[model samples]
Target chain A: MVENHPSQASKFKCEVKNLNFYYGSVRVLKDINLSVFSHQVTALIGPSGCGKTTLLRCFNRMHDLYPGNRYTGEIELDKINILAPWIDPIEVRMRIGMVFQKPNPFPKSIYENVAYGLRVRGQSQRSAIDETVEQALRNAALWDEVKDRLYDLAFNLSGGQQQRLCIARALATNPEMILFDEPTSALDPIATASIEELITQLKEKVTILIVTHSMQQAARISDRTAFMYLGEIIEFDRTQTIFSDPTHRKTQDYVNGRFG
Target chain B: MTIDNLHQLHRLIARNRFWEKIFIVFGILSLLVGIITLLALLIDMTIDGLPRLSWQFFTSFPSRKYEEAGILSAWVGTCLVILVTAIAAIPIGIASGIYLEEYAKKNWLGDIIEINVTNLAGIPSIIYGLLALGLFVEQLKLGRSILTAGLTLSLLVLPIVIVTTREAIRAIPNSIREAACALGASKWQTIWDHILPYSIGSILTGIIIGLARAVGETAPLITIGALTFIAFLPDSPFKSEFPYISFNWLQAEFTVMPIQMFNWVSRPDPEFQSNAAAAGVVLVFMTLAMNAIAIFIRYRLRRRIKW
Candidate 1:
C-alpha cells in the first residue's frame, strides 16, 4: 500500500497484468495490460464484441457475479489482487462502483436510489442518509433537477435524469474508482453530451474508466485512450497522441473509421 | 329469399336504436345470471342452516339422539387441526421456495425437485390421506388423533405454498439483489434485507390462497378419522387429557374446521345435515377471512415497500 502512491513514472493508479478471461472455454478477452491513472479520465474505444466492457468489468469483478465466466490473470488495486479467489467481490465493488450501459434506476423513489448504498451498509439514521444522498446527487450533477421531487418514483424521471441517478447511485458509496460501461450508449445525443461533460468534470477527484465506442467522445473527454481490437488492447497513449499520431496502424485505421 | 332478405335489411335499418337497446338488455341479463347464481347459493345455505346457527350449537356436546349432538368438540378439533397445519406448512413451504429460487444451483437435483413439487400439487387429496395413514398413523403411532389429521392437511397444501411462493420470489428482479450485494452486504443480508421484504406481499398472497385450499380439504381429514360429533372442547395444543396436549411434541392431537364439517355431513340424521351446512357456512367465512387478511397484508406491504 505504501508503494502505491507518489510514483510519477507510474502510469497506472490501478493495473492489470497478463489478463485473460473466458466464458466456459470461449475466450472473451485475451492477454491485456493497462494502467489507469488517478486524477485523469481514460477512455477505451472499440467496436461491439471487442471485449471493452469485459475488460472494464474486470476492475469491479462484475464478471464473477455469473458462474462459469472465468479469468486467469491479476487485476491490482493498490497492489492487492482484485481477482484473487479470497478477495470479496462485494468489497471490490464498493471500492470500484460501476455505471452500467443502461440507466437502471431501482424501482424505488429517487431519494432511496441515491441513498441505497449507505442504507444497505447499515446506516439507518435519517439525517446521515439524507446528507449522503444529497452529496452524492450533487457530485453527479443531479441534485438540482431532482431535489423537489426526490420522494417521487424514479421511473417518473426522463431518460437523462435516470442516467444521472444511476451515476449518483454509484457515487453514493464514495468509491475510489468509477467504471462506466458504455454509460451513454442508451441515451439521446443531448443526454450523451451532458454525460460526457459530467465525466470531464468528475476526473479531478476520481479515476474514471469509460468504455465507449465513440472515437469523438474518446478524444473529447479522455486524457488517455486505449484502442481494443478482438479481445486485446492494441494501443494506449496520451489521448491526442493516440488520436493524431498513433504508432500502431490498426489503431490509426480504426480511429479514422476505416473498418472495425 | 331476395324479398325476405331485403325486407329484413329495411327493418334493421329502420330500428337501429331498437337493436342497440335489445343488445344492451341481453348483456345486462348475462351479468345478472352470474350474480343470481351466487346469491342463490348464499340464500339456500342461509335458509337451511340459519336455524342451527345458535349458541347451543357452538357450546353443547355430541349426543346419540338427533337433537342433542353439538359441534363443540368437532369445531375445536377442526380449529386445532387447521391452526397446527398452517403452523407446520407455512415456514417449511415458504423456506423451501426461497431456497429453490435463490440458492439452488442449476443442476439435476434442482430440476428434479421443481418437477416433483409441481406434480405433488396435482396429486389427489385422498392419496395424501392414505400416505398420512401409512406414515403418521401406522408407522409413527399417532393414532386417529387431530395431530395426524393436521399433518395430512399440511402435506396437502405444501406443494401449493411452494409453487406460489416460487412465483412470488421470481417476481423480484435480480437488480435488487445485485444492488444490495454491491453495497457490501452478505448473501444472507441481501436476502433478508432486500429479497424477502420485496417478496413478502406476493408470498402472503400465495399463503392465503394456500390456506383457503387447506381449510376446504375434507377427504384427508376423514381418512384420519375426524370425530363425527365430538363435543368436548380441546384442552389445548398442549393438553393431553380429552384435549390431548403435551409439552413435548411426542404427544399432541388436534382438530380443525373442515374435519367438523365432514363429521356433520356424514351422519344420517336430518338435524346433522343442517348442522353440516352450518359448519360449511363457518368454514366459508373462515376462508373468506383468510383471503381478506391476505389482501390486506398485500396492500399494506405494497404501500410500505413500493420500491
Candidate 2:
C-alpha cells in the first residue's frame, strides 16, 4: 500500500486510474494508478522495457498513432476522461506536448521549427507567431544562442540545441502539459545539466511528466517519482522518499543500483 | 611469435593482396567496357554529323535536298509531346504514389497492389504503347497526334515515376512524421507540411529520369504509329488571341527525334544516314541534359537536408 503525502494540498493536474496498456494483445502496462500535481514535475523511472515510456505515452494518446495499440481505463485531465473514444486524439495531443528521446527537429529553419505547432493550430498572425516563438525559445533557454540565426536550418544546430529547438516547438503551442522522453540521453553532461535545469524551471508554467532511465536525473529534477518494475509501479512517493526510504524492496534495490 | 609463423602470415597476406589487386583491375575493366563503347559511338556520330550541324540545319524543315533538311518539325514535335507527357504523368504518378505509401493500409490488398506496381515497371514499353493505342487512340478516337504520343509515353514512364516517388517517401525517417503528428497536425497536414517538402527533391529526380527514358524511347512512339516524315511543326502552344494558350498543339500530328533518325537511316541516300547520326547526337544530348538537371537538383536538395 502506498501512503499519501502528509500534505495533500497540491491540486491534481492529471490522474491515471487503473490504466492498462497493450501492444497487439500483449499487455505492457498493468493497472497504473498515479496522480500528477499541477505545476509540478513527475518523473517515471524504471529499467528499460518496464513500461515507463509506454505509460508516459498514454497520457497524450501517442499510442493511437499506431495500429493494434489498446488502452483501457481513465486518464483524466482536470476531472475529464481524455481516453474516451469520442474524444479525438488530435484534441488530446493539442493540449499536451512531447519531446522525443533524440532531438527530432524538422528539416526546417529554427524559427519555423518553433513556429510549426502554432502554424498547425492556425495561429496565422505574423506578430503573434513571432512573439510566441520568441517566448518559447526563451523558455527553452535557447533564445540567446539561436536568435541571430532564426532562419538557419535546425540541422545546423548542435545536438543539444536541436533538442531545445524541439522543446521550443512543443512549448509554442502553449500546451497544458509537456512530456519528455529521455530528452537528454543523447547529449553530453553539460547539455544534460542545462536541460535538467530548464525542466526544473519549467514546472512553474506547465505540468511535466518525464520518463528517464537515470534515477539520479529523476532524483534531481522530479518533485515526485514513480519506480516501476515489470509493468507495475513498485513505489510512488515524493522523490526524496522514493530514493531514501522506499517502501518496497524492489524499489529500494533498484534505486540503490543494487539491481534493476 | 615465431619467424616461421611470421613468414606464413606474410605469405597469406601477400596472396590476399594479389587477389584484391586482381579484383580492382577487373572492376576497372568492367567499368571501362561500357564507358568506352559509349565514347566510341559518340565520337563516330560526331565525326559523321558535325559538318551537318548548322543554324540552318536546326531552323529549316525536312526537304528532298539532304543539306536543306533540318529537324525543326521533329524537335518541336518532340518538345510538345514531352510537355504533354510531363503534364499528364507527374501529377497522376505522384498522387498515386502518395496514396499507396501514405493512405493505403498494410494489408493483403495493399500487398497485391504493391506487387502489381513493381511488376508494371518490368513490363515491356511496347505493351504500354499497345494499351495507349487501344485506349487513347482507338477507343477515344484520338489520332496519332502529339497528345496521343505524349499519353503513350506517359503510360510507359508512369510506373517509373510511381516507384521512385514511393522510394523517396519511404526514405523519410519515421521520427519526422511523429514530430508533425505530435504537434497536433492531422494526417493531411503532416503530409503537406513535412512529407511532401522533404520528399519533393527526390520525387523530381525520379520524374526527370523517367522523362529522360521517355525522351529516348523510339519503340513506344513507333508502336503507336508516330509519323516518320513531317514537314511542319505542331501548332504553337501560345496564341496571340484571347486566352493566349492553345490546346490545338496537342491534337496536331507529330514526329520525335528518334522517329526522324529512324526515317533518315532507312532512306537510300547516304547523306540521310549522316542526318540520322546528327539527330542521334542531339537526342543523346537531350537525354544527358535531363539527367544533369536531375543530378543538380538532387545535389542541391541533399546539401540542404541531412538525415
Candidate 3:
C-alpha cells in the first residue's frame, strides 16, 4: 500500500465540484466532485457510457466545439474557474492539452505535427519551433525513430509511433496539464505497454487526467484512481486503495473483474 | 437433416449465384454501352477533324473562307472567360461551402439554404444566361463582353463548385477538427492551417470538373450575345508600359468554341461542316484534358492522406 503523504493536499492541480454535463436535453453527467494532484496521474475508470470520457472532456471544455452540449459546474485549475462563462474555452484549451484515443496526426510531415501547437500559439521563429519540436519528440520518446526523417508524412509512421507523435504534439505547447482519453485503446499490446510506460514517466512533468476503460491500465499508470459509475465518482482514493481495499462495493466489484 | 432438404437448400444457393452472375453481366453491358457510344463519336469526329488540325487552323481568325478560318479568337475567348469564371467562382464557392458546413447553425434556415443551393445546380443553364442578361448586361450595364459572359458562366457553375467544396470538406473526419481545436487553435486557424490544406485536392477536382462543364456550354453563351464570327483578337492583357497589365480585354467582344462551331454547323456551305467538326474535336479534347488533370491531382493528393 502506498502511504498517504502529508503534503498531498497542497499539490492539488485541479478540482472539479458539483459538475453536471448535458448533451442537448439529455443529462449525461451527474453531480461529480474530484481532485487531481499536481505532477500525478489520476485515472477515471468506468464502463462504456458511464460518462468517463465526458467528464474528462469537461476539464478543457471540449464540449463547446459541438452545439447543444452544456456544462454547469466549476472546474478550477490553479484556483481559476475554467468553466466560468467569461473564460474563453480556447484559452482554457491552450493551458490544458489532450490526446485522443485514436492516433489522428494531421496529413502533414512528422515535424509539422509536433510544431502545430507551437505555431497555433503564434510562435513564428523557426529556431524556437525547431527546438521545441525536438524537445517534445524526445519527451514523448519518439525522437530516435523519427529524428532522421522528420519531413516524412506522419501517416507513414506505425500505429505506435503515430500515437507517440500525437503525444509529442500535445506536449509541445508546455500545457499545465494533459488529458488522455483511452490513448492506447487502439494500439497493440506491445504499443500499449510502451504508451503506459511513457504515461508513467510523463507524470514527472505534467499532471495527467486519463479516462480508461481498462482497470488494469488505470492501476498500472495512475497514482490516484477515481471509479465512476453512472456519471458519478463512486470512489476516489489511491490506486492501491481503489484496487485492494475500496470502500465502495461498486469499486470492489469493478476492480476484481467481476463487473464493470 | 434429410437429403431432400439438403437438395432444396443447394438449389436455393445455386439460384442466388445465378442472379449474381446475371447482375455482373448486366452491369458490364450497361457500362460498355456508354463507353462504346462515346468512343464511336470521338472516332468519327477525329476522322473528319484530325486532318484539319494544324498550326494555321489554331492561329488564324474566322473568315467566310472555311479553309482559312481558325479558332484563335474563339479559343482565346474561352480561356479568358474560364479564367474569370475560376477567379469569381472559386473563392465565393469555397467560402460559402465553409460557412455553410462549419459556421452555420444546424437549424431550419440552414436546411432551407442547403436545399436551395442543391436545387440551383439542377436549374437550366439558359436561365442563368437570361438572369445574367438582365442583371449584368442591362441593370449593371456591363455590356456583351468577356466580362459579362464569364460572370454569367460563373453564376451557372457556382452551385457545382459549392456542392463539391462542401463534399470535399465533409470528407475530412471530425477527429481532425477536434485535434486542431484541442491544440488551442482558433476556428479560423484550424480551417486555414489544417482543414483547407487537407481538403484542397478534392476542392480542386471539383473546380476543374465545373470548369470542364462550363467549357462545353453553348446555350448560355449564345443567350449572352457572344459573337459567332470575329476577325480580330482582344487586346493583349500584358502591356509594355508601367503597371504593365490591362483590363481592356475583359471589356472586348469575344467568341467561344461552341459558338463558332454552332455558326459553322448552321451555315449552308458543306466545307463549314468540317470546320465545325474540327472545333468539336478541340472542345472535347479540352474537356477531357481538364478531367485528366483533375484525376491526376486527386490521385497524387489522396496518396498522402489516409484516415
Candidate 4:
C-alpha cells in the first residue's frame, strides 16, 4: 500500500547496530541490527514477551525503570549515540515521547493535563499554554470531543477519549519521535480504527515506532514490518513485500498464522 | 461388649469436642467481661461526674483547699499546648510522608530510614520525654516548662504521624505517579503539583488522630515536669517564676487536663474524686470529637475522589 512513497527509498534514519539488552541475568533482546526510515511507521510484531515491548522501551530508555535492566551497543537517532553513557536518559525521552498500554491520565483537568509538561519545563504564561494544548489536542483528533470540556477532570472521559488525551499529553511536549506500546490494545474496534487512522496521519509529521501483537493490525497500519522471534528479528522489510513474499520462512509462516 | 469395642475409637473424639466447646465459651466470656467493664466504667463516670460539671469547673482556678477551686487553667493550658503541637506536627509529618513515598530511592539508606521511623513509632512515650529532657532541657536549656512538655508530646506522637501519613500516601496507585511523570514533570514537581493534593485528605485524617493521642498524653508531660498548680500563665517559656503574662506559644510550668486530674484524684477530698471524673469526661470528649471529625473527612474524601 506504500506504493512509490518517495521517502521509502531513503536510507536508514535510526540505525540499531548489534544492539543488545538484558534484565539481571536474562537477555530480553538479542543483537538486533536494523534501520527505521524517518517518518515511517515500523511495526514490531511478536508473541507476548517476545521482547516487543522491551525493544519499544529501548527506543526511549524507558526500560531503565526496571531493576537490573541494561542495554549494550547503539540505537542511533540521526547517527547520534542514544545508548551511550554520555546521553541523559531524560533528554532522550524528551526527544522521544511515549504512550502506554493503558491510558494513564493524571487526576487533573484536560487543559492542565496537556499543559503539564510545558508547565514543568517552566512555561507560566496562560496564552502560550492554552494555544499549545489546543494545538496538541487538535493534532490528536481529541479537540472536537473535549474542546467544550477542557476544564473537566480527564477521568470523566471515555477510555478511547482518555487514550487520545494521553496522546495529546505527550504531543504537547512536541517530541520528534513518538512510541506507542499497544496503544489501541485496550480500545474497542471503532476506537481502534480511529487510533489507527490517527497514527497513520501522525506518521506524516512525527516518526512513529509501535509494538503490537495483532498481525492484521500490523499489515493494516505499518509501512514496514519487523518479525521478531525469541528476542531475535527473523525478518525486516517493506510491509507489502513481507506480507506477500517474505524472505525468511519463519517470517512468512508468522504472517500466514502458521506459527508465532 | 464385642460390638461396642469397634465403636470405642470415636469416644475420645466426642470428649475432645466437649473441651473445645468449653474453651470457645471461655473466650466469649472473657471478651464479655471487658465490654461489661467498659460499659460499667462509663456509667459510673457519667453518674458521679455529672453533678460536679458546671460553669464553676470552667471558671475558677485550682486551690490548695480543693473544695473552693476549679480546673479552668489546666483546661486552657491543655488546649493551647495541643494546638501548638498540632500546628508543628501536621506540615512536617505530611512533607516527610510525601518525600518517603514519592522521592526516596529504593536503597539501603531509604530502608534504614524506614526501619528507624517504624522503631521510633513503637517506643514508649516516657522515652520520648527522656529524649526531650536530654535535648531540649539540658542541652538546649528550654527549662522544665509547658513549652518543653508540649514539645515532648509532639516528639512522642511525631513517629505515628509520619508512619500514618506515609501509609496514606502509599494507598495511592503508582499509575497516578506515572501519569504525572509522563507529563514531563520532574520528580519533586510531580509530587508537589499532583500527588500531594490527592493525598491530603487522608493525611489530615491521620493528623487529627495523632492530635487526639498528643492531647491525651499524660506521662510524657508529667515526665517533662509540668506543675499541678499555676495561678497565672507565664509569658515566655523561660519565665517560669514571672508575674503571669498569659502568652500562648511560650509556657512555663503549666498544668494540662490529665496532670490536673491526677493531682485532684490523689487528694483526700471525695469532692476531688468527682472532679477527676469530670476531667476524665472532658478528655474523652476531646478525643472523641477529633476522631469523629477525622472519620467524617475520610468518608467525604472516599465519596469525593472519583478515580
Per-residue lDDT tens digits of candidate 4, residues B1-307?
A: 5757757857878888999999999999999999999999988987878777888877878887655678788887888788668767777777787788766787899999999988988888888877888898889888877668767877777787888888877877776766665555566776788677777788878888888888888887777777887777545434456655445446456789888889889998798888888888888888999999999988887654666
DockQ of 4: 0.45
CA lDDT, candidate 2, residue B187: 86
Candidate 2 Cα outliers beyond 4 Å, as residue runs: A1-10, B1-25
For model 3, residues B148-178, the per-residue Cα lDDT tens digits are 9999999988999999989999999999999
Q: Rank the candidates by DockQ, best first.
A: 3, 2, 4, 1
lDDT of 2: 0.91
Q: What number of clashing residue pairs does each candidate have, in the order they appear?
A: 15, 0, 0, 0
Candidates 1 onward: DockQ, in order: 0.38, 0.81, 0.86, 0.45
1 or 3, greater by TM-score: 3
Show pairs that collide, candidate 3. Answer: none
Per-chain TM-score of chain A in candidate 2 equals 0.96
- Runs in model 4 deviating more than 4 A are A1-13, B1-34, B65-68, B103-105, B234-248
Assess the local accuracy of residue A28 in candidate 3 as a C-alpha lDDT between 0 and 100.
90
User: What overall lDDT goes with each candidate model?
Assistant: 0.81, 0.91, 0.93, 0.82
Per-model B-chain TM-score: 0.82, 0.95, 0.94, 0.85
Could you estimate the TM-score for every candidate?
0.82, 0.95, 0.95, 0.87
Winning candidate number (lDDT): 3
- Positional deviation of residue B86's Cα in model 2 after best superposition, in angstroms: 1.0
Candidate 4: lDDT of B186?
Answer: 62
For model 4, what is the C-alpha lDDT against the true structure?
Answer: 0.82
A1-260 per-residue lDDT for model 1 (tens digits): 11344654454679889999999999988889998887688899988899998899888887777778998889888888889999988889878888888777776789988887887677899998899999889988899999999999898888888889988898888888889888898999999999999998877667899999889989999988999999999999889999999999999899999997
Model 2 Cα shift for residue A175 (angstroms):
0.5
The DockQ value obtained for model 2 is 0.81
Better of 2 and 3 by DockQ: 3
